[model samples]
Target: MNRSNTTALTQPGAPMKVRNVSKRFGAFTALDDVSLDVAAGELVCLLGPSGCGKTTLLRCIAGLERQDSGVLYLGDRDVSDLAPQARDYGILFQSYALFPNLSVEANIAYGLAGSNRDVVRKRVGEMLDLVGLSGSEKKFPGQLSGGQQQRVALARALAPAPSLLLLDEPMSALDARVREHLCTELRQLQRQLGITTLMVTHNQDEAMLMADRIAVMNNGKVEQYATPQDIYDKPATPFVAEFVGQGNWLPFQRSSDSHANVGGMSMRLAAGAGQAASGRLFCRPEAISVNPLLHEENLFPARVREITFLGNRCRMSFELNQLPGHALTAEVGSQDLPRLGAQDIFVALPPESLQVFA
Candidate 1:
């Protein structure tokens, strides 16, 4: 896909749809029929591990990488072949690619240089103030810190007031402290301006904090796209459940409509009612409870393998008797911390919190 034309920037509404976009590099396929809809004033984050095609999808949307097939629409206009500059999109690179030769003010004004000089100056000043860079506009990129440089980059992108703002790892360059501060500021600024934004990030915590919806991509495909709460509570696939957080994969065989044989013990599964061959059960760390005396109906006896202290919470890994060749990782509160390297610690696996995948 090559964008030979462009669109105007002063649009009235917000909505972007990427339909059946596919791209390939040599014989290796990069994107495989990826599609997503972003609403007006909504912040959607494309999240995945490295080499999962998140960045490739973003580049396709920006028209920097042409797709082998499929169409990208900005509102109702099809921009599958439109040029990047003509799409009227504001894109911020991960490295804060600011011009080292220009001052901060000049960098912001660069985007609007085609307009009248007075109008450009006014917009630059407004953008600099918006990004909290009031008086340092005279400083060049070399004279500013990483955080300041990133702010200048953001101001420059916003100076044109593009309809859709694209952020690719905007905070990845900042330190932990600065990343936290800027993430909050970015969220606040996007909301205040009601800009439709699409961000690509590999950090799960960053996606949960910054986006209204998250699209988890893997192997050039979207595994799941949902709200933060939904993604955390109910993941669609084993990959999603495992990638989103810490969990245990318990092996079990379907024995009947309502029950299954896990290891040697008969366990009931809400989903085993169907005649499925075999499946892996998902149990979150917080859902498994330590009960010496198995009181629950489907409770199992396990020995504590290891315990890791993670500041606010403690993680307990256990080995179940019925489940062979598998270990469970559980999350416990700091106050409810169990003894380290202890054995014969009985644990209960709650059914409501259990998710299964074949």
Candidate 2:
């Protein structure tokens, strides 16, 4: 359904919807039955591994790439086949895509087509200031640093005040230092303007830090779309659970009741035991605790395999001799890390924290 006709889609007050959209390059499928929604003024980030059709989907929405089937709606307009310029959306690419000959001010003013000279000047000035690039308007693209050039690109995109903003890995081109600083600044700017924006990023940290909601895609399909917390906590599938965070799967033999023999350690299933299969148990690194006091239940013996010291925490891998083929990882506070080498460690695997899947 197109919301454009009801006067609600573009309301700045309304939402944007992407219907069952699919794109194929001859027999190769780039996007398969993808659909999602963004509330008015909401920021949604599309995240996935490379070649997962994220860019194709973003391009389709921007009118830069057409889909084989399904409709595209912006605020209430059916813009499935509209030209990129006609769609009235602003885009920022990974490379910044700034015109080398254009001065900072001109680059920003490029999108303000035919507005009065005074009006154009005012908008450009406002955007430059908003993006913290106030005095460098006359500098050409080559004169500015990479970060400054990016700010210019951003200023240009926002200058038009397009209802919808599309960003394709906008930070991938920047150095690490600039990328971190810009990520916060970009998010702040988006919130301040209240523009409904969609960004495509392969960096999980970027997605988690910037988006109000994230749509995790894989193999040309959206595996999950949810709040960053939900996507990390209650992943809908094994792929999602394994992909979103660090985890390990242990083999188990199913018992008559809900219990399973996880390796030689018979671990109890928390509630939905009946639904689990006999083969594997999903254990998140953070879910397992290595506290000194061991609880009577869920505690197991394991030898210390290796320990890597990370600034805030230490990552220790525990090798279970009972489960020869599997290993468990745990993150312990640097101060709480147990001395290893000669000492054996007894770890507690809370039943509630373990997820058993086929």
| Candidate with best TM-score | 2
Model 1 clashing-pair count? 8
Error of 1 at 88 (Å): 1.3
lDDT of 1 by residue, 295-343 (tens): 7756877887888889998888778876645778888777776442357
For each candidate in turn, give its C-alpha RMSD to the true structure in angstroms. 5.3, 4.9
Cα lDDT of candidate 1 equals 0.82
Model 1 stretches astray by more than 4 angstroms:
1-13, 271-275, 292-297, 338-342
lDDT of 1 at 73: 89
Candidate 2 C-alpha lDDT tens digits along 249-347: 787877746577876678877885337557677777877767446465677778778889999998888877677546679988888774433547777
TM-score list, all predictions: 0.91, 0.92
TM-score of 1: 0.91
**Pairs clashing within candidate 2:** 3-76, 4-76, 9-75, 10-75
